[model samples]
Target chain A: MQILLASSFGAYLFALFRKEFIYAGVLLQLAYLLFRASELGRLPLVGPHDTIVFFTACAAAFSLPFGRLMKGEKAFGNIISVSSALFTALALVYEPRNFPLPPVLKTFWFETHVVLAFMSYALFGVAAVFGYLYLKAPQSLAETLQYKAVLIAYCLFTLSMIFGGIWAYLAWGTYWLWTPKELWTSILWIFYSFYLHARLRQWWAGRPAAVLGIAGFGVVMFTYLGVSLLMKSSHSF
Target chain B: MNPLKKIYQILLSLNTSLWLLLIITALFIAGAFIMPDNPGFGSIDIPLFDWLKRQNLESVWWLWGTIGVLSLLSVNTLFCSIDSIIKKRRVTHWLLLISPQVIHTGFLFMLLAHLLGASGSYHGEAAVAEGSAVKLSGGDILAIKNIEIETDDSGYLSGWGVDIEYNHSGNFTESARISPNSPFIYKDLNIMVKDVQAYPEAALLQVSRDPGAVWALAGSILFTLGILTLIALRMKMEKT
Candidate 1:
């Protein structure tokens, strides 16, 4: 309770000092990562959503530093807050377990594959948020940030497919089965693929780009959450 | 034409492509909604004849891969959109030329490989009883290399395990198992890990062929690297 309270307060304080806030928030997030690790010892992350929370938390911690890299408007502090809030909420929904993974997920590749997957998902999630804002806001400090966010997000979605394929090869005995999850995820990425296309094409700039952001992100949510609820999670053996 | 003028010209025409995508996605969504949730083992025959239909099976035609037509439709939307971007030269040469773009091109190749990749299948399930030899997906002979089953204190759905070894086309040997999760890949084929069925020594597995498997792999590797570079760059920027 105290740790979470302190972390929330720390985030609030950092929000006030947006300039230096990103770095301060990152350090605090890193501490929180350690804090969670200590409580559970080793990695408390297990299960589908559990891993998502764990990696998103890490990505949130890392995004601050990444946001800092952007040239002009450095509003990573805001990004961090959003990410942290998301992870915190996710934590409420998913509980970490110590149980061993099912047979198909018992491989070393499973850990690497899933960890990278959730991390990328987290990054995409942030990008989706920016995409949403980019479409709605006529123009603001976030415009430049939104473009950067899409570039980064598209990159992650692209990789998610790549890693997913490799992981699929190792576990499911095939790379692309066109399963609901795989099919939808690939479609989601393709949607963004064109979003990037449009953005670079510059003909469909701004609002069109933002619309892609919404459509692609919706697909992501569907692939990540909707699939499990509607169908299944993990490709299975 | 000046670059800006050319760019504007392209923008004016994006409307057609945009409307087309909207129509396609809407139909896809509506079709998905109307389709039955569970389309049981409907006849999965390569060439469809109405009488060939499996009885009581209602799986969506699209869900069955339907000769990959549904996927191709979606793929068409993606390709057209990509073409529009390319035709206009709006591609971010710098970013797209980097590791991220490599990831995209890799994915495209992988999908192509999956669709056009050379692959084969195995039908008969292999049941090995603690060190027995059996044939796998292809005609390749595989032996139950090892078998170890662990039961928890109560042993209620805790799961079981087994290991398998097989010889590939050119004497290449591979093995797979759960609990540790190391699946074997032989030549272009992958004989993934599995649990022994009733005997705790036999294994069940799925087999496939996608000649472009390597491209899928390459795409994944590049994607990871691209992500790392982007994040790492961000981390470095935070430091300064």
Candidate 2:
């Protein structure tokens, strides 16, 4: 708990200074998460709510690599780092360690498949954020940066659906159930597909696409978090 | 026209993508909400609603359709990956090879493996504790040993848990408990415990296959590189 607080504080402080401080923030986060991972792996966390918290934290962690890509724009790293810290803090608060995996998640696909699917979902979550920001640029402030984020998110979102289908097939008798979760994901995929096309067409520019990117992130959240709780499906969460 | 110019033009166009995404999302959202209070059967009188389960949160249609869309996506990806490789775009090769875009290529492989390479199957029984092997049309058998209905710590049922053995082609045998979350995998096939029936024998499992999973890992690495490259370039541009 103390470590969580410290990491959060560190992320904020790093965000403020950015260039010099973000690395330290990232390092602190690694320290905190690595220590906590063992404890986390023991919990159930199978339901939709639990998966959301778990996936969000992972997405934040995945964002770390973007810092290296973002180059000298430590602000990018700072943003990803602090946001990840914030997500972890939120998870600790709302998601108790008790959300154990139900019987459904015990399958090979549920454990490994869902984990990968959600991890990709988490990564896309960040990409969606960056995508929104990119499409909404004051003057395409960081066009390349925005593009990178969108591309990354697109890949993750795409993978999440594909892997999810495979997992669904293993769990259910069919590969495409089009349940709420699947529907939202397909919708999300279609949106990204268009976003990809938009990028090719240069239609939305930064603002509309940015909004869509942000919105895509929301859909990603719906697929990852909302669908599980609100809808009933054969899926584990 | 030079290929580079054509490439730039195609890459930069957004109208096609934006409108298509909007349409797709609209249809999906509409499909999601128009559900009956009681799903699975007709809560609504519309005959099409029968064909289309209530777009309820619990609708089976949503699940089935998602699987379909993803399967299509995998095929599309496979086609594009093949095109990218065969069309011999020097720039695309570098782009796909260097950027997270390559992950898309890997994703194609993963999807193909899950879709075509694995088998999805289900498990069920006619009555409780009948303990008979659920037979598959493919000649495999899932023999049951016991049944336990699982629940939360609060005792609300999460789902069913079955201790069963899977015999494949009469040569391979392994034991696993098929519950909602705890599925069994054999020979790359994944078996999930969907439901159990009392009177008529019924068992459910979702199956998937992907031959290109390892490539996704490689694509992830390339994606990280692409991200770094773009970020680095952005920072450099900002500084200058």
Q: lDDT per prediction?
A: 0.53, 0.54
DockQ for each candidate? 0.25, 0.28
Best by TM-score: 1
Best by lDDT: 2
Model 1 misplaced regions, further than 4 Å:
A1-42, A48-52, A55-59, A62-83, A129-137, A235-237, B1-36, B39-105, B117-124, B135-140, B150-180, B197-202, B205-212, B218-240
Task: Provide the TM-score of the second chain in candidate 1.
Answer: 0.56
What TM-score does chain A reach in every model? Answer: 0.72, 0.71
Error of 2 at A207 (Å): 4.7
Candidate 1 total steric clashes: 8
How far off is residue B116 in model 2, in Å? 13
lDDT of 2: 0.54
Q: What TM-score quantifies how close candidate 2 is to the native fold?
A: 0.59
In model 1, pairs of residues that clash are A66-B234, A107-B181, A200-B90, A201-B90, B39-B59, B117-B211, B118-B211, B119-B209
Which residues of candidate 2, in runs, are more than 4 Å off? A2-10, A17-37, A40-65, A68-89, A128-141, A204-208, A228-237, B1-21, B36-38, B41-125, B128-240
